[model samples]
Target: MAFPMQAGPGENGVDLPSTARMHDYWLGGSHHTEGDRAFADHLAMVGPLIPYLVRTQRALLRRIVRYLLGQGVRQFVDIGSGLPTCGQVHEVAEGSDPPARVLYVDNDPEVAADGEDLLAGNDNAAFLALDFREPDRVLSDPAATRLLDPQQPVALLALAALQMIPDSDDPAGVVAGYLRAMCPGSYLALTHSGPDPQLAYACEMFDQMKFGPRHALYLRDPVAVQLFFTGLELVPPGIVPLPLWHPDPERDPTLQNPGQVPVHVGVGRKPGFVD
Candidate 1:
């Protein structure tokens, strides 16, 4: 059980770059400590492409959120959602009509604390300590249950986090289980890292970091990644590289789809009834 506002070195190590803070640092957020930046900077040493890839992934997220909102989704459960930043889901969701009720799920206490402090007044928002790998426990979290109504259409958004799970813990199965338990009409929006050839050589360098590269399963092919949405009906245009998925021609390619795009994104709907 994690609590909000607590800060310390984690059991794995202190102040090192875990996925949450690394992402926190990349997104130009303040919650990340120096150690987090150190690791992220180290990753930059691996290749210039890493940072560009990170930023593009974020842009894809922004595009996806707007698209989902346009499609009438009013509820969202964002797993592995890192620290706060501009152009984030909440900002995009509320910026549109039919305001979204969002539940942010991340195991980091500091992120939760910051969210609680910053987003407390929001009637439609709350944050909970949730590990994406542990769906059972996450679904049980009060913040998740209270804000998200399973009977209604809820967007299950997991981006850049699924790679943390190896075969021993099936992220796809986790997604399937979550969808199985939710009422039909629920949507799953996901973006996961894939092995772009350019990123391959950087793998060894990441291994020595605070969170070893060995812990990551980043080589999922497009076909393998598609398994995550097995039972659901993919929105028209189906699963595709992030760049080609609902592109807005008005936006510059650099900002719209930057660097070597290594993530695969899609929105799938669980077919059934709303009851």
Candidate 2:
């Protein structure tokens, strides 16, 4: 499924690198351009552990989906879902006993266009071209309302995406808005890069990259990251490094190295009545 790298004239122009595409490239996916690869390679040079960190993030998403499936969650809203690569939410969630419904959201024109095309024949899944910051719009969007029942438990995934939402955007409020609209048993699985002293040089390098403000990275402390899960109850290992979150021996065999990854991951449940 080869998607257009450049969605249209001036939309996702080949001149600019896409953060989503770079992520795909880091995960060894084929949906990225040379510019994306170059950026990823630069990151790897600055922070040799970044590629491994990304892989860890990917493993966590898979684990979270499987865990949600085990809990009988059949609907998902993956906000800021980048380009559809391997182990997408739909594939993992639908693989359960009863297939799941997924609505992927992204403001990137290229991602939305390609995502809709990717799920063309899949009735249970869809993609929306919307920003996650506007929780009201996202919750009320026709596609999301049509596919997901707000009265039921829907797994909301903010994986690796929240970092793109800077402090001025009031990301915490955005998360709370989603939680308020969700039913009691609904779950929120999120992962964000944590501030690390070891990554100072990498951070410097990232600052130099001078990507668009939308693509700029924001590394938040545990306290700030935990705020996103404010009203929810953490599952376990509360806001630990990505490798420590429900460390699945099979999926992730290298949990022994706790400090290997600088990303933080967690899953929390919204307290209330369950349907």
Candidate 3:
């Protein structure tokens, strides 16, 4: 009972779908392959409101970085950094008082390749082929140290990526391992998909559910999502449904409906750290 060899899709013949491609399709972007399209369309048809929920999660990440910069953080390790994003971590850093250095990590070679191409000829930035599940490898990579000084206060971003790890990978432990490896002053910026009871329960209604029988998952509850932030001090407003966590208030008027868009997000600091 082995899963078919899933490659990083566009990068080789191993034949696998990527979180990045699925996201691209969700954002109405065209970089996805036929496989990506099929999955996205299926998920949308099932819930009929997943894309908007997906974008709100991105908004949550933006809010977290702006808050982190306000706290004097000057370095970032954006694990799960996938395809080129608009006004991402580096952009948010530059918009702050003292610029921050950032390291982007991902296991998909195609994602790492695309990231490198997007940041072509730029300094103050670097991307590595690393997976969040392997925190030790991510923390020890030469490139990680090259672009950032861990001793300095830093922020780690998991944003919408943790669910990709299967239950067997020990997702909670993986999160704890990263926190221990980060300097005390480090921060974690995050978001994740969660289940809502009224969102259509018909199996027949589900089109892609792409992770298929084992490819994807959702946190399902606030407690499960909050457990990932264990041993950290939550920033004011704490972990709550995405749109409710310090949003623009004037953000998009469309965000008023909780059911149409669902997500859980938060920002936490490793206690026992200083500015």
Candidate 4:
């Protein structure tokens, strides 16, 4: 579905480029403005692998939802969910035996508004406008409570989302708060940009360009990313590059060379047996 792009900094309030819009552009969606396109093009020039990284991250998200569905997780909380698009959590979960409940959370007003409209008439899914850093607000929101059962297992997805949060915001703490809020047997499927030497120039460009005034990119090392899964049991193939994590050869035929992707992804389950 194409989102309407208005002149000037629409609804989101930031004059600078928006990460969500640029991501949409990279995904070949028509939800971005000219400024977002230009910013994405400039970044692509510096790091040609960026678009590939974005696609691989999206592929991993689909894999994650399917994996969770296999584990009998019927509820999902997708934090920092950007523009609604094909292969989103709810779309992937639509055919499950017991219908899945998906709650999409985003701090962007435009994303939230668009999501609410897109999910209209879909009783199993809803969207909330809240910052992922504020776990309390997200978990306490009426939409979340209405769709998610506190007693059941849930899959908390943060695909390519945590990288937008800087270090000073205590990303680890933010993750921990969500873990605390989720019940036992729940899962956390997350993907974050890794600190790749090849992308140093692009990283510098992001810092200097200030692509999004509200969102800053932060690439963390594997050791640091692992800390976010504290007190949880990581699934097999722990913290590997996006394609390497539970890869489905049939689905990702084009992802031949997985080593080129510089995003770390993994799923960790809370330490408790599901009754």
Cα lDDT over the full model 4: 0.78
Highest TM-score: give the candidate number.
Answer: 2
Query: After best superposition, candidate 1 residue 84: deviation in angstroms?
Result: 3.0
lDDT values for all models = 0.69, 0.77, 0.68, 0.78
Give a tens-digit lDDT track for model 4, residues 10-119: 35544555667777888888777888788778777767777777777777788889889999999998987877775789998899989999989887777677778889
Q: Give candidate 2's total backbone clashes.
A: 0
Q: Quote the lDDT for 80 in model 1.
A: 72
Local lDDT at 168 for model 4: 88
Better of 2 and 3 by TM-score: 2
CA error at residue 220 for candidate 1, angstroms: 0.6
Candidate 3's residue-wise lDDT over 142-165, tens digit each? 877777776778788887677666
Ranking by TM-score: 2, 4, 1, 3
Each prediction's TM-score versus the true structure: 0.84, 0.89, 0.82, 0.88
For residue 107, give model 2's deviation from the true position in Å.
0.7
RMSD of 2: 4.0
On residues 1-275, what C-alpha lDDT tens digit does candidate 1 reach at each position? 00011132233333455555666566676766787777667767865676666666677778888888876788888887765464668987877676788888777666667667768788888887666667778877787778777778878988766765676787788887677667788899887766676666666545554334334344677788789988899986887777777776676264454335776778899887765
lDDT of prediction 2: 0.77
1-275 per-residue lDDT for model 2 (tens digits):
11112232225554566667767887788887888787667666766776677677778788889888888899998988887677788877766767899988888877677778889999899888887888899989888888988778988899877777678998888888888888999999988877776566666666687532233567888888888888899998799987788778976865768786777888999987784
User: Judged by lDDT, which candidate is best?
Assistant: 4
Model 1 clashing-pair count: 0
TM-score: which is higher, 2 or 4? 2
